[model samples]
Structure formats: C-alpha cells, structure tokens
Target: MTEPVKLYVYDLSNGMARQMSRQLTGRQIDGIWHTSVVVFGRETFYGQGISTTLPGRSHHGAPLQVIDLGETAIDEETFNEYVMEMKDHYTADKYHLLEFNCNSFTNDVIGFLTGGSIPDYIKDLPTDFLSTPFGAALRPTIDAMYRRPSPSEPTPPIPSPIPAANATPDSQLAASILQAVAAHTQASNSTPNAATQTLYAPIHAITNPPSFHSFLKSHRAAVAFFTAANCGPCRMIEPVFERLSEEKGVKADGTGAGFAKIDIGVGLGNSLASEWGIRATPTFIFFLDGKKLDEMKGADANELRSQVDLLLFQAYPPHPHTSLSLPAVQALSLNPILFTQVPAIDTVLTRLSSFIDSNPWLSTTQSPGQAKQTLTGTVAPYLKARFSAAPSSKLPSATPTLLTSWSQATSAIASALPVASLFPLVDLWRLALLDPSVGTWVSSFPTSSPILLFIDKATAALKIPDPTSNPRNYLLTVLRLLSNTFATPALARSLFLTTRAALAEVVIPSLLHTDGAVRTAAASLAFNVAAFLQKGRVDKVKGGGGHAARDNTLEDEDWEVEMVSAVVEALGRETTSEEVVHRLAASLAFLLRLSPAYDTQLSPLLDVLQTRAVLKRKLTKGGCGEDGVVKKDVRKLVEEVANKLCP
Candidate 1:
C-alpha cells in the first residue's frame, strides 16, 4: 500500500527574520526556511545528523506550512534502506548553513518518495542569503560559528594504526575473492539454475478472477497449482511447489515467472478452479503471457520441474555463452580491486599545506585571508574535525564547504603550480574518493567535472616527452585515485560506461610503468574494469538482463582486445612484485570469464599472445622473488588461470 508523503516547512526565524531582515541585511527575507519530510508516521530531518520521530514531535515545535506531496508507492523497507544510504552523505559535520542543510535533506527525501521538491522559497533561501552584500560579509563569521567544537562534544580518541604502504591488504581482498569464488562454484554445481536464482516473490494464493488475471498479466510466465485439502498426492508435493515459487518466481525487478496456488474448496470457493476446468485435485496449469500454455494432472515433482524449465525457456532463451564448459573462467572471482586504505587526515593536510606554502606563486595566488579561509580555515578544519568523534562514531561526510573549497583549490593549483607539484593535492584527492559520498557527488555530474578534469590533466602529464620530468608520486597517486573510483560501484559503472576509452589510455600505459607500485595500482584499476564487464556478462547469462542494464554495459568491442593485450604484456614483464602479477592474472581471468565472444575474440587473443607460456615462466622462474607465502598465493592464482584457462 502507498503512504502519504508530506513536506513540513518550518520558519527557523520564528517571525524574527521578517521583522528585522531589512535592518540587519538590507534585504526583506520573509522567512528562514527549514524543512522535513513526514511520511509513514514519522517526521525526518537532518541537523546534528539525520533524525526521525513521531510526526510533529521534533524540536521544531510546529511547521509554518504542511504541503501534501501526494502518495508514495515506495514501501517502508526500501525507504529505510535509502535513508541508511543518505546517512553516509548527510552526516552532521557535513551540514552547511548556506549550502547543505535541513532543506537539502528534505529535498532529497521528497525526491526519493514522490519525485517532487519543496517550494522554491525554502530551497533558495541559502542562495538568496549568500547573494546579498551584508550576507556575504557575515559568511566567514557564520562558518566559524558552526566549525567551532561544541562544549558537549566528546574528546576524540587516537586512531588505530594504518597498515604500512608495503603491506598487502590480503585480509579484506582475500576474503572477498574467496567468498565470490565459493558462491560461483556452489551455483555452478547446483542441480538446476533455479536453485541459485534470487528468491523475490512468494507463492501467491488465488482469490477472485480479477486478481488472478492481474497476477497472470504481470508475470512473464505463471503456474496455478490446484489442490484439495485431503488429497494425499497434493500434500506430498506441496513443499516442492513452494520451493519452486521462491526460486523461479517473479524477481525483485518485476520480471521472471510467477507462482500461484488454488484450493477447490477454500480459494474463491471453487470459482477460479471451476473456470479453469480443473476437475483433478492435483492439477497443474501453466501460463505464458496471461494465456494457458499446457497442463499436467499429477503431483510428479520431476514433471513439474521440467514444465517450469520449459516455461522459462519459452520466456527467456538461454545465452549461447552458457553452453560453454569453461570451469576455470566460471569459478573466477568478480569482486573489483579497490584501494580503501586511508592515510592520516592530519598528515595529508600537513603535506598539502607545506606544498602550498613553499611555492611563492602558489602562496601569493590567493590573498592571505582567502588562503586561510579556504585552505587553513575551511579545508583543514573540516578534515580534522570530521574525525574528532568518539571511537564508535561513524565517519563524517564531506561538507558542501569542503567540496567548494577543494574545487576552488584545484582550479587555483592548476593555474599557479606545474603538473609535477600536484602530488600533494592528488594524494588528498585520492583519499577523498574513498568517501562514498564524494564518489556519489562526483558521479552525479553528467559531463566532465572537477574529478574527471583532474584525471584528464594527470593523464596528459603522463604523456609528456620527458619521462624524467614525470614525478613517480604523481603517477602512483593518480592510479590509486582511479582504483578508488570503484569503491562506489555506481561511480565505477558510470566511469566505464561513459569514459572507457579515456580510462584505457591511463591504465594501459601505467601497467608497463617502471615502478612496481605504479604497475600494481594500474593493475588494480584494470581489474576493476574487467570485473565490471564480467558482472554484466554474468547477469546476462543469468537471464535477468534487462534493456536498461544492458545499456550500461561497454558496447565497444575493441576494448576487450586492448585490455587483454595489455594484461598479457604486463604479466610477462612483471617479474618482481607478486602483488602486480596476482592482480594482472585476476584481470585476465575476469576478462575471459563467460565472455560472449570467447570463441572469436578472447580465446584467439590469448593464444596469439602466448599467455600460457608467459604465466608458466612466472611459475618456473620464481620471478616474484621467492617471497614464500605471497609467492605461493600468487602462484596458485596464476596456475588457476594458466592451467584451467589457457590449457
């Protein structure tokens, strides 16, 4: 059932702003607007973080206006999931008086629920306030007021030690890869594909003809299980039918087959059963596109299963790739390589400041006051104060001021400093991308934004004629930033779906970089891209592929060939770092795994590149340098690809 969604608009000034606005700011601002969403018996708002309570129960006593936003078809469970995700983006420290504040949260929620926004006056108040001369004069003072630590705020505890740069993040990466491999293996070994499909809809009970027909009309295929209470065969096969419903029934995306049950005596008082001409107690009638296809009058479980498979086959023809016997590729993990390690925020900021202060051009580009306000005052304070919470508190989202400050800083750095001096700023940007909120904001832009522009500039720097002029720190930091883009899957998908060619330019060359760290980071980025393609292929093979999902897939056929060639070449050259070899091997595995053109493209490409010989040399030469445990792990991963994939 749909729930009524309402907007609760409160005047934060309580009539004072309208009375004194002309005297204070020389602008007649009628109200200081704050808004919250009221839905499902709760009033939700964001301030010192997001809070929800009974309607009309928040600290803001009464709303100045209650706007009916119509009904929301969004269910409670899905809505709650959305709120949890929003928390990561709308943390308390992220609140900005003139930017991201109470009304911003309400606007987001209202959009999620009803696809509508609050009144212009409420949303535009911040922009209006900041535009005035008097308001602009007070902006810094206002920012300082909120940036001040609250007296009641608890002292922050010392953060746990971060892992050394040389240490591999084997625990997190290994666990994820092993888990994916285990699931894929189990699914492949399952008897029927239905056993592995996600369970979404349950076995619906037949009611009146209208409801019954509605169910049939909605699903691609459906089955009506007719039974009587006392029939022995019906009782025996009931559980089997239910199990089938959950596995092969309508999926969450509203596709796939459906299941319904009917009893002659109980359901619709034999109305549906009589209309369908069901005389037998244990009858099964199959449907496709709201019309009866076939029927069977028995409780034979095997026959029922066969009929369900037939229904699905008629609905969605199997992909040709599914017929291949590629056990090695099938068992490969699909988890993308991610760089989630965070450096100390204070240390990062310190290095950034030193870089800025040392350069005369950079130091004087902005006035001392502007420099302090944007960098020292706003940027530094925001990063440090974000972590000044109790140990158990969640990390804060990047504030609107921080985003604005960082963007301005990037623009300033581009003009005042050369490409080589960008390592400090690039390092900070790399760490910032780990924050999912930052990733979300970055992806929301439909065209080239700050982050993308930064990447393009960095990539251009890599292509300069003088190799010695390229700073290794800049290259490694940029590669790491590219890897962290996959930390948020949506951002990763968008990047690949929109800018695969540009990404290929960056990743392909860095794979062959002289520095092992740069090569390792580049391999991780390549692994993420390959993993994304593998996921799309797996989804298509699983029969859940929709037109929209397919649209997000990489359509350029040349990309697969380019990526495969690069990985093969890099793996052959990477003789020292076991980490680089491991990532490159995994990248190759994902690229070749369940590929639609395995016969025509990837298989022939691997053969021509002599990938088997290259991997075999790594195993025989001990090129990863006899680093015992790591060497063994890398060997095992390489062997999985060499023996199973290449052989």
Candidate 2:
C-alpha cells in the first residue's frame, strides 16, 4: 500500500510580512514560507531539530495552503527509519532560517517519497528575501546569530516520536541518536582536515566494535578493509576498493555483497583492529556466513578482487536458471503503462457546457439537475486549473468533497446522456483518477460504482451489431480509461478479485479488437494485470528466505488460465502490429514465469492450445508497419517465449 504525500505550506511571519513587505524591504514579498511534509499520518518539519506532530497540530497552527505532491509506495516503518538517520544532520543548533530551514528539510523528505522536489516558490524564498537591499544589510547579523561552534563539541539531535507497542523504546531511540552524534563528532575530530569532494563509494564505514560485529552478523558474506591515516599504501588502494564497492556491493534486493572499511586512527577502529589481531596498517579480511574465511595483509587490487569473487561464490551458489539464454524476455520492463496526456481543458469544459445546456431532463430533474450544477460549477473550474497548469507546478488538493461530488455527478450525468456522448466525461474522470485522493476513493467502491457503471454501459454498447466489428469511440475511450486506473495500486488489486469477471468480460473481447488503437489499449491493460501479479510473486520470493525459491504466484488460477488463453488466441490472430504481439508475448511470460503449477496448469494448457506453433508462425509471418521489415526485436522476444514454453 502507498500513502498520499502532501506539502503543508505555512507562512512563518503569518500575515505580517504580506502586509508590511513593501514598507520593510522596499519591494513586494509574500509571507516567509515554511513547508512540512505530511505522510504516513505524521507531519514532519525542522525547527527544534526535525520535529514531528500530528498533521496541522504544530505550533505554527494551520497551513496557508496544502499542495498535493502525489503518493509514495514507502510504508510507515521504512519512512521512520529514514527519519532516524536524518536526526544526525538536522540537530537543534544546526537550524538557520536562511541557510537550512523548514523548506530544506521538506525538500529532502519530498524527494525521498515522490522523487520530486518542493516547489520553487518555497525553496527559493530565502534567496528572494535576501536579494532585497534592506534584507541584504542584515545578512551578517543573521550569520552571527547562527555561527558554527568548534568541530569537537556537537549537539545531539532531538529524539524521534515515541512509537507504539513493539517499536523501539523512547530511551533506546534517544541513546541511538546520542551514540550516532558522538561517533560523528569523534570521527570528525580524528580525521586530518581535507577538502570535501563527492565520491561514489557505497562502502560502510565501521567506527565502533559493536556496529562492526552487527554488520558481519547481518550479511551472508562481507569484506572489511583495515587501514590507518598514515599508511600511504592504504590511501593509494582506497580508490580501487571504492570502485569495487560501487560496482558489486549494493543491490536493491539486499543480495549484493557487503563492503566495509575501518580507519584504525579514529574512535574504536583501533579496538576492532586489535580484536581481529591485525597489526598491519592495510589489511583485508573476507567473511562468509559471518565467519572469517580468508585473510590478506596487503592491498593487492587483483588479489582482493579475486578473493571477493571467491567469497561470493562460496556464499551464494548460482541457480541453474542463470544459464538460460533469454535476454529478450528478461529485458522487458514490468512497469504498468499509464495514459497521462492532458486533453484541452477548455475544449472538455465547452463540450460539458453544451451537453448541460442542450439536455432538458438534466436541468428539469432534482438529483440530475444538482449533479449537473456540481459538474459545471465545481468540477469544470477544478479541471481547468489542474489540467492547465505546468506538470511540475503544485496542484490544488483534491478534497473528499470534490471527489464525492465528481462520483455522483459523473454517474448521474451518464444516466441522462447517451452512451456515445459519455466519452468526454470518462476522459475527464480518467484524468481525475490520477490524483491519489480521487483514486483511493473510487477504488474503495465494491462492485457498484459510477466508474464501473460507465464501463459496463460502454462495453454493453460495443456489441451493438456484431462482436467482430471495430469498437466504437465510447468503448475505445472506456478501455483507455480502464488501463489508466491501474495507475493506482489499490484499484488494480481490487479489480483482480471483486471485479475479476467484469474485467475479463471487457478485456477478452477487446484483445481481439479490430482497431489497432483499441487492441493496443487492451494489451496495455493485460500487461498491467500480469505485472501486478508478477510483483506479488517477486516480493514473496524476495521475502521467503531465499532468492532462488520457485513460488506459486497464481492468486486466481481460473482467472490466470482465462487471461492466458485469451492472450494466446490473440497472438494467433494478431498479424498487423508487431508491437502489440510483443506485448502479448511479454504478458504471457509474466503470467507463467514463476508459477509453481506451470508444468501441470500452464504448460499443458499452452501445449493443447498449440502456443509454440502460433509463435513460430509469427516469426515466419514477419513484422507489421512500413514494408514489413520483420521487427527483429519482436521476433527475438516471441522466439524466446516459445523456447521457454516448450523447454
């Protein structure tokens, strides 16, 4: 699950700066901007050193504006872990209004959550204020107020929020912060002063014996470098060691080899060196399963590399699947496809206005008339402002009221309008669902929802004359909208279970769509379904003790068989677009890749359906578009899938 991330913008000077900015600074300036990040049920800001409070309950009182920064897949436990690490750099005495204030802290947190930074208005407020002549004169005074003390003495950061039961105790949390701050101070004092430069080394620095022991116990295999400041050979070989760390030491799945270093001249580094019985200035030790396996005294780069590789081999044996030649299928991205293109806001609003003006029943009835008024008055301006803004600009919050109104208005308006005329409304709602607030609300709807109603009506209309005929604009737009709904993870998960049959009804027939655009949209939706299911398996495998375990990923075996059968049939019929054929093949790979019952359930089903023959014929038939060049990439992928199926 993901939490919606919001930026709470508070005016530090309240209304005073806005009122008296011209008189004080000889220029117009907005209120002094203070921003905090609100996520996972906590509002975190930096003032008295990274404080946290319930949202909107800070001493700063209410926020002037709340901007929707989007959602993050980070859970609360992981987010708090980040906060604990942040306590070191954001101490109470480190606070400076102009240099590193509330906005600085929020920008970092926001970047971590959404991979996006805070707005320019909030971030650049300090520079804008200091640029004024009157403000420039007081810069020195402000600097004097927040002067840095000696490097020896450092203030401990404020304690983190007291977590609930089964969490880290308050005393334990405070002790950890103090220990970290003390270690940082000791390391700073011990190291010879040097110019700072950015380095791409990911090696963990061991300062104390306890942490060193913990690090060794946690990783299956680890390498520790022991060195001192005065050792010339240590300095010379450090760069090579850093390069190795960058290349093979860090991984997202936590299976990468561990690399660490200890400086014998700083803090308890000497204690570790003595405990490990290392008398040399530059020494290397390789460990496997938390026991010392191999030891080398000198920093021979070639020997170090070979020993590290040997340690990894001993720790983690290679899986047989690693021998498979399936580069084309392996290279396929598992990210879901989302249609985020913004249509003209004025055009959409104008069409909505005309629809409302022409329909007599819409204005004559009570609920429908109120719904029409809500659409025109509330939703029209909302879309205009949101869709018209730049992509990076902060958007107005989609409140619960607006979402509720939109749901009722769209459903009520659909009842009054013809199925063909509902495309514009679906398109508008599609854009609205991109907002996390709106998406979460709509996804919580059980089986009956206005969005689902529109989809059912649209698909029901598609079978008007013949099933094989090309889909109408209404159904095409509805398919695109359905594909976009997977942008919200919750909605995608629910669609697989409660509304599984409804989704299969719309997706199966659409996969064989006559129009390439309709077929492409249907393919995108199928890819999303497969990706979501594949993710569950990938996560399970990662969490289930070993990376090489084969896990049963089928959440619903019946639905999986149904979707795979449709895709296989679609592949046989697909001759026009090689890109669509590649998507179908990729979806098939995701569905069958990690299934425990692949041999019994999927492979036999594929064999009976003649999947290998269908794929080989595609290779023979060649490509679509532009003189039939036989898209080599598509053929490679299809051939690979066929091999996997039959092998």
Candidate 3:
C-alpha cells in the first residue's frame, strides 16, 4: 500500500501564537512559527530532525496541525536515500531563519519522497512576511536574533509570547527582537572538505553535446576539452583526457555523473567552437556553476590534469566511500527454480479440456481459454523443439534470425490464441534450460544472441496485472529460470547490460502486487537478477585499479531507486508467505552487497533497531506446522542479515 505523509505545523507558543505574531509583525496573523513534516514510510514515521514531541525537547509543545499530504509513491528505502541526498545540501549550517530554513529543508525532503511540495499557503507565508513594510522595518532585529550559529547548525527561533517560559536565551533574544521590531520603524540585521572526497570520472569522448546550455547548467562545474584532429599533444593526452572523463563525468561510486567532451574540429563544433574563439588543439574551457571559471591553451598533461582536477572537485565534491565490493558475489546461485513446483500438465489439462477443447479452431472463438487450447497442439511442439535436446536437422536459424522467427511465431499465435496459450511453453523452456548441455550450447550460439529477444517477448507476455487469472505465473517462473543462465560470465554481462531493464520492468513493480504469489515471484526475480548484476562486475578497468563495470549502470536512476524502495516497503508489511518475506530479505541483502551506495551511511534500508525488533517478535511468536517453522527460521535469518547489512 502507498504510505502516507503528514505536514506538521508548529505554533511553538502554545495558545499565544496570535499574540506573538502581533507582537512580532505589529499585525494580526495566523499561527506561524516553525513547521516540520513527518513521513510515514512503509514501516515507521520519520521527522526532519527532532520535534516538540520528542522527549526532553517539548519546549515547543504539540504541533498546531498534522495535515495529511496523501500517500507517497516512493517506499521507505527510496525516501531514506533521498533524505540522505538532502542531508548533503541541507546541512544545519546551510539554514537561514528567513532565506533557507527548516521550511526549505522540509520542502526538499518531501519533494524527493513524493513529487509534491509543502502547501502553497505555508510556502507563501515567508514570502508574504518578507514583502510587508512592517516586516522590512523589523528585518534587522529579526535577522540578528534568529541568525544560525553556523551553516550546518540551525538555531531557528521558537516563537513564544513569553521568552522566559522556554528558559532558553536564544529563544528569549529572538522573541524580544521580534517584539521590538514590530513596535519600531527600524532596520534588521542579516544572517566537503577536500581530500577525504572522491571524484567521479569525466566524459572523454570526442563528440558534440546535445544542448550545451543545459549540459553545463546541470553540473556545478563542467570542462569542455576541445581538441583538434591533427594535434600531437592532443594525441599524447588522449588517454589522460578519457581518464579524466571517467573520474569527473561519472560518479565516485559509479552510479552516474554529469560532464561532457566536445571537439571544435567537427561539423557542429565548427560554429560553436568558433563562437567560443577556440582555434587551438587541446584547449580546455572550465566552467563552474554555468559560468567560465578559466580556460587553458597549450597546457601540458600536468597543467590540463590539474585544471580539470580542480573543475571536477567543484562539479562533484568527493565522498570518501560511495562504493563497496563483495568478492563472493559471483558465487551466489540463482536457484531453487520455481518450475519445480509446476503442477502436472495432464491433470490440469483434463480439468480445462472443456473450456479449451470446446472451440477446435480459434478463428471462430471469442474465448481466450478456447483459443489457447487450439494453439496448444501447434505452438507447444514448436517451443518444445526450441528448448529440447534433440536436433530438428533443419539447420537452426542464427540468434537474430531465431528472434525474428520467434517474434513472428508468437505474434501469429497471440493473434489467434489467448496469450496464456503460450505461457506453458515456459515450463518446457525451463526444464530444457536446466540441462548443462542445453544451457551451455545456447550461451555459445552464433552472433547476436536470441535470448535477449526472447526475454523481451517473455516479459511482454506477463505484462498482465492478474497473475492468478491465467498461466502468467508460469511465465514469471520462466523468467526466474532464465536468470540462472546468466551465471556464465559472458552471458551475465551481456544480459545485465542489455536485458536487465526489460526484466526489471517486469519484476520490481510486482513486488508490491496485491497477490501474495505475484509478490513472491517478483521478489525472487529481483533476488536472482540482482545476484546476476553482482556477478557481472569485473575487477579492473582500462584505468588503474578502478572498476568500470558499473559505469553505464541504470541502478541509480530515479525509476530504479523508486523500484527498490517499493520492494523494501513491501518487506516491512505483515506478509502471508514465508518465501516472499525470505526472498525480499535476500533481495535487500543482494542490493546492499551490490553497492556501497546502498550503505547505511547514506541511506539505511530500514530503521535497523525497529526492523530487528519486529523480526524478533515474530521469531518468539513461534511456528506450529512445517510452513510456520520455516517462517520462524526465515524470520531469524533475515534479522541477522539485516543487522549486518544495515550497519
């Protein structure tokens, strides 16, 4: 279920909110002091920092209004990741009582969690106050009184009728200043270290940027390494330029980054480069915050590297540890395959014979059930041949050719039969794939593997919402089986880079599906796929010791984060299936193991203390039957894994 978010309005002065406002602004006003937002994630509730409700911190009393902002689309994990990202920009030192305050922080946090912002009324309050003549007259005292101790340390004044009631000097001073300003026509007062950081690789390719204006604007700083074709020094530094690209253009952790490369010698560059007055090779133009910081001409390797290095730091300040590696990742297995649980075909077929055999030919039938039955005899054999050990002696088509055949065959059959008619084929496909001989042979097949195309079709087949209605469940099972094939390193890399998104589209959302079985399958699919993604990473890249495997990954993309968030949120719920819960836990473990970006330092998957407590309670509850015992065991294991991974 989508989680709820609440915007908490704090008056801070108990019942004296109106009096305090009148005393501060010399005008009757609505309750306005400090505001916070509490997000009810999948599992627990979270507030910006601390609220008046916090123990030993009740000087501000209860909130004036706890306004429900509707359900958030992102799950808790994604929200937490976003919260960490905001912490990067919204440190206490950045706070200004009037310019950048708790309210701004609240807006950024909620914006990341839900695409929505703080209420229009609440946002307009400060702008309204700042625009007023009386507010202007008292601006100096207000600014002086509420000045933040430091950029990262916010000491926003708590509005109260009597400053002595709070027993805090800062609050007292702020109240007095507000009161004095209202009565007077006066003016007002005003309000990563380098090294331990990492640099994302820069873009090194010689190409023109799409929308240069937007590209430079996106990064805090960007360098356009313009080079000429005949430049010898340019050739000498080509390697360094590319290395710089990797360091500054990509991410420190390699999720993704922002930077670019352009050559004036090119067609489009002819005009743009001339506009910039670049006539030399290896000319480096450095920009910070969309304005030119500096430029370099005839700069040697040392000079170019140093200048770009500085630009990179400005563009992407280094974070000490954004990445993590696990050596045992490749050893993780994809099984136990769900196909083992497939029911006997003959028994199910006998029961459905009436629904299917009723219409011998699909051309006249409107029912998917009946149409499906007719194609069973024809397409089943074709697919079985595709998967089976025996040779057809027809000289099988090339991988791409096979894809064309598969697409044509499926399209034709789908037109006549219900899509479910082709679902059973996956069962045959899984069994044949399990055989080492068949799996290896398929992997080694000629150029342009057809498995990629097959995956695209298989995912399209299971796109239906209702898993229980047809054999769509079987289709999902086949996808799990297909994940196993990627264990072959070559196949794993190819699949993850090319086919990961297609399967991800099928797997991630289904974790939140209403059907328990669907959710279980989805979680299992994620577990296997994430495991495969881990196996695909190589030890080293063209550049020294750094790994380039994840440079092109889409894992950190917004949609991907949202998907993982949904998965974690589902895990926090009261689940019915032990397998679902187990796989969900396993999937999170895989993700944590997959990258350090998923680490607790940035964003913990859950409130470790609370998640562990919940798991412990379930363990103590004790199971009775076999299923119950398995559930209990899984509960304990998940708790242990979560404990290790979260910290």
lDDT of 3: 0.50
How many clashes in each structure?
Answer: 0, 0, 26
User: In candidate 1, how many Å is residue 256 off?
Assistant: 11
Off by over 4 Å in 2: 1-325, 352-368, 389-392, 445-449, 462-471, 545-554, 621-629
Report residue 25 deviation for candidate 1 (angstroms): 80
Report lDDT per candidate: 0.69, 0.70, 0.50
For model 1, residues 164-186, the per-residue Cα lDDT tens digits are: 45334432332233233223212
Which RMSD values do the candidates have, in order? 27.0, 24.7, 23.0
Off by over 4 Å in 1: 1-333, 360-372, 385-392, 446-449, 543-549, 626-633
Q: Write the per-residue lDDT of candidate 2 for residues 1-647, one digit (tens) a residue.
A: 78999999876554656766776567776777778899988899876667788999877778899999999997888788777766754655545556455676676677667767778777656556666764554444344334444567543233322333534443343334333322322232342112111112245555556556655765677889999889999998888887777555523334546777878765456778999999996899989878999999887888887777667656653422333667886788877888888888668766866775677555423465587678778887787677665643777657778877677677677777777677788888778767776667777764334667966886687667765443366777777788777788888776666667787788888898788888888888888888878777656544431333444433777888899899999988887887788889889888877655566678789988999888777766343444332777877888888986544
TM-score of each: 0.52, 0.50, 0.38
Clashing pairs in 2: none
**lDDT score, candidate 2:** 0.70
